[model samples]
Target: MYSPLVQPAVSGASSGSRESTRDNVLNSVLTHGPVSAATIGDQLQLTAAAVRRHLDSLEKDGLVEVKSVAGSRGAGRPSRRYVVTQQGQSHLGDDYLDLASEAVRLLQEISGDEAIRSLARKHFASLEQRFSELVPEDADLTDRIRALTRTLDEAGFAASTRRAGRGGKVTTLRAAQICQGHCPIQEMAGEFPEFCEEETELFARLLEVDVRRLSTLPTGGHVCTTHVPLGRRAHASLMAHTAQRAEK
Candidate 1:
């Protein structure tokens, strides 16, 4: 569930104190829309000075813009209301890969290719481990493949399946154009060629059946394939076994 409030709750102290303050201020403005710094300070429980400093940082990032408007009844000076720019909204979600890529570029700039490669390997390993958790325990081959397909769909893969024969199933996934637009690593292919390979391997391992990749189908501008298994009912006991495992 998402919060309907103007800002997400602050969890802990941020780096350099002021840096975090700036992020909080910018995020608040982005989430809530045009609001005064004083109103922002009250919401964040930060001092006016601190809010100003943070706002300054945000302005530097081109993430926040201010609009000056006269106060009701024409006050002495116009009040400046802050709002998040389109750029700032990009930073608000877990899907901020552009920011991650910028971080990677900085790391590569400072540390060199070898360092980035090492970091990429470590990161990919972590991602693989996290993805593995989505697997249901004791799920047979077919069900596992279905689950994996569903996971891919959630991850922006336009996944669908077709029954090939009495015992065969073919799964096709088309990648979303939006996903490719933001991807940094040669889009998805060069960055994660191993992605499909691993998915194929997982399906094979979980089902104890041969999972073969078919010819490439056009998606966006690149190509992808269908994952097909030769037979059905090969893993009939999957769900029941999975349930039993859960009971344990």
Candidate 2:
């Protein structure tokens, strides 16, 4: 049973199997990202240790990233979720990126910049409305912001939220940072930044508090970060949007 030829064959087969399993794990993260290691193990029928091993390799290879998702109750530790990165997307065979970029260029040439802006606004309108329904009207800024990131995660943004800035001191600030680990329209957004701007506007309108873009995936950033000021009530923003809608 310990023959030399058989040893090579067995080693080759074991290596191939490992590679296959690793690929499967990466695909799962890409498809359902902002997903947890436990979820990945359940989906792929792999052991916890096995999933962690694959994830470590993927992270080392720049193929995946870990994001921290806040707990709903805000009482427990944040969960670590995995998302595929730009480099990972390439390995997944993103063949249409060039085509998408080309189409945006053509649109810009034919329709002008306002058209792109209008398209961007239209694109995020549904998201604004959806978030309105997803979060409670009485929810505070913190709750609404958390809901927003979760919605973005489901929409392929691979999003997460974390509290930032210094608190509990004189003249210090407490803010929330919404980080998007992936962007489905990274190429298109690069050509027409209206997409990103519109998203910011949407966040402002939905959260009723000011939001700022810290970085973006299109601008060579590994992740897109939006800076949101905290300690504001959602009702303030809600009333303003309501009045604006009535005028429309």
Candidate 3:
């Protein structure tokens, strides 16, 4: 019957979705790790069975390691916590990270810290130029934000945007949060935060609004969050322009 043909396709789709969920579980461990399965489930909204299935798979692949932590006094046995292995960390590292770090070190040795900062600025400037071109000249703040988010996502930063403020509406509060779930150069940036500083300035120029970086992955936060204040006076006009652009 037709049901026989559809059954295999449906099973394949479910398998693919589970595979994707396993990847998500690995990333969750990479970001906020040395955590318990229950904790990861809470953050990802997955059931304990689903989380355990992914964890077991990751362990088999040697991407995760488990540690037994002593429970409270008079409680049962120790709890099992999971953390990413060195191999798992390397999986998340940028392929060119070694070359980039060498280049930075050579620059520092040949010139000075100022030279390194200059190069960082130049590097981010190029990214800013590329991303700026994607936004229309007359595009409002929301469009600009969306474009930048897309740009960052394409660059492997896993960027996203959300309304944040008292009313939880961009029109009402005129502010939004830009969050980057991954940073390719996180380790390098920890030593030289000039990279972070330059990128923040680039975001300000591209968006034409004041932006504040609240946290970053290099700084031990789960995500890099930038607070962008859109100004109340232009809210209505910007929303109107965004709607017009959408219609066209």
Candidate 4:
């Protein structure tokens, strides 16, 4: 029913393909969602009429949703807003999760949850260890967390950090979102045991942080949670992004 979002295609104007323009419009919507047609035209330098034409094609293909937003306060009539649909999102990336999911499924059939958990923990540990090494030894806890948070953001986790409680508390870095649509074998990683283990291991290596299984963590039913500490300035650099993102 629900498919992961796909990455936008690369378009070259010389190719003489309308697909490129359509793709551009689609990408525009994805980045600035629920946007008005006029707004889209203004940003892309396309006329309102041209924007409508592209939108028409996208709507017909079930790639986007056009909703009428009622004006707020003393505003005038409703304006149509466009958003990329889940289907279109799935087409955005190279499907790598499929293979990983398959392997995980096989592992579950042979070993069971205990073995999978052990493998996953090692995977996460390795990630933390690598990132920890990159952090400066002289830096305080804040600096260390910041460095790690930055690393996670670079790895594609929408991460952020904040100071909570009295005494400025500790810098708390939180990953608001993770884009795994393009992950190799993403679907399989959740469904199968071996694939799950591999995926966890891979994420650890890629992000250089421990990736804990959802079941093992306090996330309830969520698939997984990766932690990046935030007590030092060095760590804060990584965690600092959270504050920067919040401002935006």
Instruction: Output the lDDT of residue 185, model 3.
Output: 87
TM-score-superior candidate, 1 or 4: 4
For 84-104, candidate 3 gives per-residue lDDT tens digits of 665665577668887888889
lDDT of 2: 0.73
Model 2 pairs whose backbones collide: none
1-248: candidate 1 lDDT, tens digit per residue: 11221234562345557566666676566444456888777778877877787788888887777878798799678889786554554444436565666776687689876655455545445434544686667776555555555544444333334444332234333111111111123233234344345444444444455456553221222223444554433353654543342232
Q: How many clashes in each structure?
A: 3, 0, 0, 53
Per-candidate TM vs. native? Answer: 0.34, 0.65, 0.64, 0.46
| Tens-digit lDDT track of model 4 for 82-184 | 8666566556553655665566557667988665655555544544666667676566544544555554434443223333233444334432223221222
Per-residue lDDT of candidate 2, residues 1-248 (tens digit): 00011000111115559988887787667545667888778777777888899999999999999989898688799989887788886675546878877876788899988778777777777677778778988888767877887778667665667667777663228887887766777878887888998788778877777678998878876568888877754466665864464233
Clashing pairs in 3: none
Off by over 4 Å in 1: 1-7, 10-18, 93-248
Among all candidates shown, the one with the greatest lDDT: 2
Which candidate comes out best when scored by TM-score? 2
The C-alpha stretches of model 4 lying farther than 4 A from their native spots are 1-17, 67-78, 94-96, 114-248
lDDT of 3 at 173: 66
